[model samples]
Target: MASYSGNIDYLAPNGVKMLKGIDNDNPERVYICTPLDVNEIKLERHPQDPNRMVAKMRVNICPLSENYKNVVRRSAQERGNANVSVPTHEMQMSFSVGYIKSVAQKFPKLVEQVKEANKERDPEIMGQDPTDENTHLFKAIRQRMNKRLAMLYQPQPPQQPSPYATPNVGVAGAATGYVAPAEGTDPLAGFTDADVGDLPF
Candidate 1:
């Protein structure tokens, strides 16, 4: 008989379904994980709005701190499953394209890592046009250029706005924010982390 390792459901405060992204309640929690695979990043159309685009990727993270490990264990135990082992490896994380870009800008090394991974996965990627956003490999080049530019110019602190100033409201893109689907929606909903191992992340 084939053994079954069942899905472990991790809950946030108030039993809200915690799927792919980092737990909002524990913003400081840290995890150890490998670099993203070459096929990890993907461009997809937004589920709620057809005109918009969102990049959906899966991130496998393992709790790095002992306290966090215990928390994961406790969460599993609270689910009434003594047999279910704490998932110390391959916890799912989600990121929007904008967040990814921000990370790249802050940590320029990440852009190089992506490029190296792409070349390792397919040598042809090295020859692809860097400006093309249609392919994942070239997208990394674009991100790399952006990272370089960001490094060239350090950001200045934002100025306080006047009380009488009209706030600017911009349309949403994969450009900013953590989640993309909608409020209270999980990008990784309806699928276990194992299910999306080959999908994204």
Candidate 2:
């Protein structure tokens, strides 16, 4: 019930390919990769299509890992209540635009911030009881737009030097486990060999 003609500004000149498959002996595909920065991406209502929208990528920032394929199969016993099962791939064939606008795109950062906030989770400032909904751990998850990312991420303990790591040494030193003497230390203090070398008359 609408009319329009021309290039849609909301579509990238070269849109991203989010999926690939075979159709009619020719390769077929879909375009729906997540933009790194939402502010750089634009979604505009289509002119002729009332129910459709155009997503344009203002810049290219897609990473390699997001384009790979992973398949998963869950057995009925693992699923807890299912008698039927099918393997699911990494990307969904059909995606809801409204849900994309409201939830999916906003989810990754939400989890990141919650993880960041959980790093600062103190039972004293929040609550001591694990069941208490007033805790920062519980509250941060509910607050979707929480900017608690300023909280420090969990720090990993420093890795100790590997016990099996090879030490630098000459061939003989390696076999004998000879450590280089430190500065100001005698190098030949432990030598028990005869120092008189062919000096007999």
Candidate 3:
């Protein structure tokens, strides 16, 4: 399958029947790939197409043990083919445009989390603000604490545009992107004085 894609059932050739490999009847033909972490999942262009809008993916599989990798290298060296890469079975899968859109609309929470996790990192946050401490251990702790505080107060990705921006929508047009904090805003908006583990409050 040079091109990983699906064909309609009606488009199938005559006298051809698909088998349900999931059945116990054919263990040899069925292959199982481990469930990969959603965060690690990525999509890349299939080598066959450089300018297509298709959704072919080249998943990055987990690395095997160094011993196993060395075995591959040793075998290659014995065969005078050190540059060749190991081969793995790849499954080509495709879904309709409707199916793709449905998956996105179905997993709004997942989509939101993925977007937030991958948002651009702050360009200004290089490290903890340097201190005049002469001790290396103290300097390291201070830098870690500075980074933690910066991450805690970092602004979130922008939310969708809201119709409530108009003056009549709410209390005088509250702009979605840049609304002044309402009167009587919580003085401690980002802090919780509650006990949290061994945190030095």
Best by lDDT: 1
TM-score, candidate number 2: 0.18
- List model 3 lDDT by residue over 1-201, tens digit each: 231222122112112222233435543342322211111122345578875433232322232465766786789999999674542222222222333333334333333333343334532222222222443322333222221111011133455865623221112122123223455543223423242221221
What value does the lDDT take at residue 146 in candidate 3? Answer: 22
Q: How well is each residue in 48-95 modelled by candidate 1, as lDDT tens digits?
A: 999888754444443346676688668889988775444333334444
| TM-scores vs. true structure, each candidate | 0.24, 0.18, 0.21
Task: Please estimate how well model 3 matches the true structure, expressed as its whole-model Cα lDDT.
Answer: 0.32
RMSD of 3: 24.1
- lDDT (tens digit, per residue) of candidate 2 on 1-201: 322122122222222224333223434433233332222234567889977768543321111232231111244446574433231111111212332233222344443444555666543433332223555544444333221111111233445765644323221111122233355543223322243121110
lDDT of the candidates, in the order given: 0.42, 0.32, 0.32
Q: What is candidate 2's CA lDDT for residue 186?
A: 32
**Model 2: which residue pairs collide?**
none
Off by over 4 Å in 3: 1-81, 86-92, 121-201
